[model samples]
Target chain A: MQGYIVKRILIAAFTVFTVLTVVFFVFRLGPADPVMVMLPPNATPQDAENLTKKFGLDKPLMVQYGNYLKNAFRGDFGSSFRFDEPALRVLLMRFPATLKLGLVTFILSVTVGLSIGLISAVKPDSIIDRIGRLFALAGMSLPSFWVGIMLILFFGVTLRWLPIAGRGTPLHYIMPAFCMSLYPIALITRLSRSSMLDALKSDYVVMARIKGVPEFYVILVHAFKNASIPVITVIFGIFGALMVGSAVVVEYIFSWPGIGRLVMESFFARDYPVVQVFVIVVTCMVVTLNLIVDIIYAYIDPRIRYQ
Target chain B: MHSNQDNLLELQDVTTTFFTKQGEVRAVDGVSFSVGKGEVVGLVGESGCGKSVTSLSIMRLVPQPAGKIVSGRILFKNEDLMEKTAEEMRQLRGDRISMILQDPMVAMNQLLTVGKQLGEPYKFHDKVRGSLREMCIRLLEKVKVPAPESRVDDYPFQFSGGMSQRALIAMGIANNPDLLIADEPTTALDVTIAAQVLKLMKEIQRETDASIILITHDLATVAQICTRVIVMYAGRIVETAPIKIFYKNPAHPYSVGLIRSVPVLGQPVDRLFSISGQPPSLFAMPKGCRFAPRCNKAEKKCFKHYPPETWLDENHSVACWLYPGD
Candidate 1:
């Protein structure tokens, strides 16, 4: 198991290196020049040259790539032109907010999703099952940004129940986190429902019932564990997706200071350092999550062994 | 029918039906039988003949919303189980009565340890005062699973087919149930393993003195462990007799054909005996006797109406026109 974890870490390191190299080139090869955006409008060619030399832009692409890799190994990704701070530091500042939103969304979606799925499976073709199916359809079909706007319009403008944008109190997180959670909730519900239905029909479930296990315990404990393998995979997929994708539109709409919003703003302003670092950090998180998922599988299912 | 005094379980006119897209399929039609205390009764039949459904009906574990016991009196220890509430039935199940399913490979929950699964009845019924793990290990040892101490912690997948079946048997007998229903316990096993399992079941039955309903299609198995035999054709019971009488002078044509089909050692024939024609489909059953189309001695009247049960002896009965009801 230790060997397996070490191997996964090595693979994750290689993946992050690949993403770092790709993002670095993509930004540099693009038409946008960071120096042009960095300088004032009345700045002279000499000023541009000084800024380019200072940031090592005058060197060859290979040399810059080499230096970037060396600095990245030491957890440095240069300084952001706009923020005039280390790009990694700027990314780190926005990390807590995204982590909060992601965690809230994850908990909300998994709880609601598994409940709906379990209820629907327990009494399939019933009224509640139909309603759950409808909820899933609407959740998956509707765009997150549109949902965020509608929520803001209803709760923020007309009803005046809560603040629409920005992050502070717990109430501020309600809309954006909920908006980001819709797709995963729907996906989890559908996956878990079908899987639970299958699990309920298995012989072991019948055995449990025959053992005089209470109906609640039979469904929740016996059938749910058997049904959970696939749902766990989808859940981890959702987590990885939430981390890398980061609900960019929802963050932007809510004016939430998350890595997604930071990446979006940095991209438009030609802040290459922040953008590159954002990709690297997100990639690492996703890779680590995948490894965690593999470890969790071994724990949930006795048949699975990590060699 | 067995005497009421010694009877542990009795099913009177139990009819279980399934409402499918095709139509209402009476899987178990007006079946009645009795299991005496410490008796080993074998319910023998071909596939789709409602043997499993009969056992499920007794347990009140029939698949819901589609399948149900439309009408019946399932009397257990002189009380009508059909009249019992769902919770009451649950309390009785895995306590007074328990079942071992057909496939040992799938009967156990793969995610849970064998010991945990075995301990569930004790946990639910609150029958054990001591540690459940110790009870589980003792049960495993009773079933002859090797290394009972550590094997109890192993999952079902780690155990072989025979071992898994043994674990299931251990679970079934955990509560010292009054009645144990084993549905084709040896069908999925090889010959040697099957014999070992049967031997183990017989030993357990002797030790616990529990009434057993052994559901299987293998006549040889029935001959080995069963005290009495009930033969079902399609959805109805065609013949029931003591094991010796069932093998020697089988009454129903279906019973005769089933016995003839089994190959006997040292009396090898070029072609084994077999009954012609498939069993009638549930969607389209014949108006008369269900076995008439396949019976060699089926008379003209046999095609027009179902026959009533005729008592051949005090303990033997046959449902066929040849044995006219008096």
Candidate 2:
């Protein structure tokens, strides 16, 4: 198990390296130039050259790439051209907000999704099951931006019961977080429902019932653990995506000061350092989350042995 | 066949039905039988013969909404199980009655330790007060699982098929239930392992004096441990007799066919004796004897009407037209 974990970390490091390299080259090859974005429109060619030299942009691409890799290894991603501060520092500042939003969204979706899914599975084809299924269908198909707008209009404009946008008090998180959680909630509900249905029908579940376990205990303790395995994979994937700023649209709409919005604004401003650092961070989060999921699988199912 | 006072469990015309998309299908139709105290009754039948369904009915664990005990009484210790509330059944289950399912490989929760699964009966029934782990180990040791102390902590996947069967047996008898239902407990094991499991069950039964209803398609298994045999065909009992009479002078044609089908060792034949034709479908059952279509001796009367149970002796009965009256 220790060897397996070590191997996973090595692979994750390699994956982050590969992603950083690709993002670095992609940004360099793009039409947008950080030097141009930094310079005034009437600046002279000499001024441009001097400015390029100042930022070490006049060097060969290979040399620049080497320097970028070396500095990145030392946790010294250069200052954001837009923020005029260390890009890693800027990203880190936004990290907590995103992490909080991700965690809240995760907990919200998991509880609601798993509850509906479990209820639907336990009493399939009933009124509540049908309603839950309908909710899942709408949640999965509706665009998040649309859902966010609808929520804003309903609770913010029409009802005037809550704040419309931005992160502050817990109430401000309600609209954006719920909007962002819809897809995952729907996905988890569907996956968990089917998985639970299968688990409930399994021989072990029947054996538990025959053992005279209370119905609730049989469903929750005996069947739920087995059912949650597949759901956990999807859940972790969604959470990783959330952590990595995939909630850009919702964050943008809500004016939420999260890494997702930070990445978007940085990209438009030609803040290459910030964008590059964000990519690396996102890649690392995804890889780490995947490894965590694998480790969790070993605990949830004894049949899974990591050699 | 035993007196009511001595009977640990009695099924009086119990009929379990399943409501599927196709229609309502009677899985177990008007089945009546009894298991006396300390007796081991074998419920023998081919696949889809309602043997497993019968056991599930007794446990009140039949799959719900779609399947239910539509009619009849399941009397346990002279109490009607059919009349017991769901909560009452739950309390009775694992406390006084327990079941061992077929396919030991899949019959245990993979995520739980064997000890945890074994301790479930004690935990749920609250029958034992001491350390659950110690009791689980003792149960494992009783079932003859090697290295019970350490092995109890292992999961079901770590145990081999026979070992898993042993662990399941351990769990089944953990509460020392009054009635233990084992549904094809050894169907998934090798021949030798199957024999060992049967022997273990017999030993447990003797030690606990728990009446056992052993459900299996293999008559050889029945002969090894069963005191009485109840032969079923198409959700109905074809014959029921003491194991000795069942082997020596089986009455029903299906019973005779089943006995003949078991190949005797060292007796080489061109083809093993097999009862031909598939069992009737649940959707469109024959109006008469359910097994009439497959019975070689089936007459016009057999096809026109179902045969009622006819007594062959004081302790034996057969359902066949050939028996007539006395």
Candidate 3:
């Protein structure tokens, strides 16, 4: 167990390092002038140079990256050019909102998707199965942005049932969470349904049925528990994907102050420090989520529990 | 013949058909047999001879999409199994007639613990989760599992193939069912373990008074453990007789060939006997007795028409013309 944990942590750390290095170099590679962007338009060249030197961008690219890593180790993400605040501070301020959105969407998608998938599998030839397949198809085919717009137009514009955008109250969260959940919900449904289908027909299930276990209990307890490994893995992995993907469109559409919107704003102004820090933070979040998913896999399946 | 007094279960003209894309295939074609109380009736046949299908037909456990008990009356204690609803059949399945399948390793669920799997039947049948812990321990002990209390919690993989078979046997007999259908229960185990399990099953059967339907392709296994043996060829019962009568005066050519093919340990021979032909396909079965294609005593009548089952004695029957003075 210790060895597995250590291996995972090292992998995560290496991934974070690779992501930081790539983002730092990629931003630096752009011809955009960080010095000019930082300084006022009326400032003298000497003042621009001073500002560049203070921020340590005057150094070579490798040296600048090394300093960034050193500061990163000590919780020192440089100040955002636009916000005039520490990059770390901006991230910490915005993370909770994104976390809330992601968590709600993740929970909703997995629960609804798994239930529908199981229903579809259990009554395979019924209308419910057809409906589940259609839902899964729509979830996969429709882009999140288009789905979000459609949802807003239908629920917010026409029906006046939900807020179009922004995340403050519970009502503000519903549309964005629904939009973000689409693909994971679809993916999880298909995966769980197929796995459940396979599990239901297995010898063990027949054995369970022969033992006089009620049909519902056989499906819910024996088949579902056995089939869960794949669906859980898919859902957890999708959480990381959803977090990154939803951050931008959801943040923009909702006008929610989140790391996703921060990245978007940084993109428009070419704020190198903000962009690099945002990339690193998102990378860390993904790596951490993947680690947690791996741990969860082992926990749900005792066969993997090491001595 | 065993009178109706001892007959616990009987199947009359049971035919199981599987519908595939091509056509319907009669897997078990009008097979009939019975098991007496406390009797071990061996269904001995090579693979695809419908031994397993016959067992599944008796338990009503055949899966859908391909398999179904198309035509038959499975009489369990004078009750027509075909008339019972699936729910009704399910109730009688584990408590009254339990099954232990071939491939013991895959037969039991890999995910569930040995104890949970063993205790599951009791919980399902008895309707009370109380006493499950004690019941599980007792079952483990009944199946001869060592450290009954501690080892019960381990997964199927934790136990050896032999041990898993024992665990499966324990689960099958947990409800103390009147009939235990063991479908090649020792096929996956090594020789010694196979012997141990067969012995354990016999011992348990004697104690519990449960009739056993032992399904196997091994004639020697039937010789060792079965009280009566049914030799199936091409989804049809070619011969059935009491153990002593079967060995002393085997009537069916198939059973004789099968017994001769088994390598006897101390017998000197130029070469071991071999049944020379493959089993006929059920889809395009031969017109006569299914074994006539391979039979040394095949006659013109044997090739043109299927033979009626001829009674050799009160206790023996063979589905071949040669037995009735052809």
Candidate 4:
């Protein structure tokens, strides 16, 4: 088990390094002059040259990437052009908002979605199953942004029950969390229902029933635990997806000053340092989540752990 | 041979039907059998003949959407099992009767360790709580698994197919159930391993004094182990008798054909006998005898009406018009 953990960490580190190398080159390949965008219209050519040399833009791509790696290793992400602050500092300032929203949304979605899925799976052709299927269909059919807007209109504007957006108070979390969870909830429900159905049909489950285990024991102990594998895969996949993608529409709708908004601002301002660090950080976060998922998956099923 | 033992379990006119979108499939058609204390009864049938379905129905383990036990009384020790609530049934399950399913490789949960798996029946019966380590070791020993103390902690993958089957048997008998229904328990094993498993089951039955319902397609196995044999065809019992009587003078044509089909060793090959044609689909069964189409002795009247069961003697019975005179 210790060896497995060490191996996983090493693999994750290598993956992060590969992602960093790719992101560094990919950003350089884009058709845009950072110095040109940074300078004033009447600035002299010497000023542009001086700025390029200062930021190491004048160096070869390989040389610049090498320096970035060295500095990154020492926990120095350099200063952001637009924010006028260190890249790491800027990231730290805005990340908590996104993390908070992502965590709450993930918990809520899994709980509600798994419950509905289990209910539907247990009584496949019942009214509750029909309602769950319809709800899943709606969640999939409607876009997250559209759902957010509708929720805002009904709950915020019309009923005046909650605030429209912003993350300081508890009310700020409601609309954004709902929007973030829509697609994931649908995905989870569908996956859980199918997997649970299959698990319930397994021979072990039949044996459990023959042993006189109650219906709940057959469903919960024997069936549900086995069904969780697919659900867990989807959950971790959604965790990375929700954290990265949940940023765009959710930040816009809620006015949450998270990584999504920061990255967008840096893009418009042509802040090369902030943009580069943001891509690297987001990539690392996603890769790390996937690695954690792999570990958790193995833990839940001992067969995988030993293998 | 009559031990004057109490009937430990009985199935009275049990019919399990599957209502599919295509049609209603009568998987178990009014099948009835009983097991007395410490008696071993064999349910013999080909694939899709409803032996497994009858076993499942007796346990109420039928899949919900399509499979339904339409009519019957499943009585255990004079109490109606069919009328029991889910809770009551749950209480009776591992504690009173347990089953050893076919394909032990799939029967045991692959994810859990052998110890955790064995501990489940104890937990199910509320007989043990927390750290069933010692109990698992004893169970492994009881099933004749080597290195029980260490092997208990191993996963199902670590064990060979035969070992896993023994582990499953251990789980089935953990609660010392009064009745054990083994549904083709050794079907997935090789001939040698099957023999070993059957021997272990017989040994366990003797030690525990538990009644057993052995569901299988092998007549040789029934002959070797069972006291009584119930021969099923197309979801119905075509014949039933004591093991010796059933093998010596099978009254039903299907039973006779099945016994003759077994190849005799050290004999010259002539034309290996086989029951011609396929078993009828349960959805569209013939009006009279189910095996009439394949029976060489089938008569014109056999096509018009179903044959009532005929009692040939005190211990043998046949569902055929040919035996009506008796």
Q: Pick by DockQ: which candidate is best? A: 2
Instruction: List fnat, each candidate.
Output: 0.77, 0.84, 0.57, 0.66
CAPRI quality of model 2: medium
Residue-level lDDT of model 3, residues A31-105, one tens digit each, is 878888777789998998888888887788889888988988887878887888987887788888888888888
| CA RMSD, predictions in order | 2.7, 2.4, 3.2, 2.4
Residue A114 shift from truth in candidate 4, angstroms: 1.8
Clash pairs detected, candidate 4: A211-B93, A211-B94, A212-B93
For candidate 2, lDDT tens digit of each residue in A1-307? 6676677779878888898889889888888777788888999989989988987898999999999889889999889888789999999999898889888988999999998999999999988799999999999899888888888899999999989888889999898888888888888899999999999999999989877788898899989999988899988955787535447888888989988999999878778788888888888888888888978887777777523
Which has the better lDDT: candidate 2, or candidate 4?
Answer: 2
Query: What are the models' TM-scores?
Result: 0.92, 0.93, 0.89, 0.94
Show where candidate 4 strays beyond 4 Å. B1-5, B126-132
Q: What's the TM for model 3?
A: 0.89
* Ranked candidates (lDDT, high to low): 1, 2, 4, 3
Model 2 lDDT tens row, B1-326: 65478888999999999999989999999999999989999999999999999999998888877999999998999999988999999998888999998899889998989998998888888767788889989989999999999998998888999999999888888888999999999989999999899888888888899999999998888889998999999999989999999999999999999999999999999999998998999899998988889989998999999988899788899889999867
TM-score of chain A of 1: 0.91
lDDT of 1 by residue, A46-160 (tens): 9999999998999999999999899999999989978989999999999899889989999999999999999999999898799999999999899887898999999999999
In model 4, the Cα lDDT at residue A235 comes to 88
Which one wins on TM-score?
4
Which has the higher lDDT value, candidate number 2 or candidate number 3? 2
- Candidate lDDT scores, in order, read 0.90, 0.88, 0.85, 0.86
Question: What is the C-alpha lDDT profile of model 4 across A1-307, one tens digit per residue?
Answer: 6678778889989988998788778877888887888888999999999999998998888899999889888877778877689987898899999889888888988998998899889989889889889989988889877888888899999999989977788888888888888888888888899899999889888876766666786788778888998898788855686667768767877678898878888878888778888878887887788788888878878877886
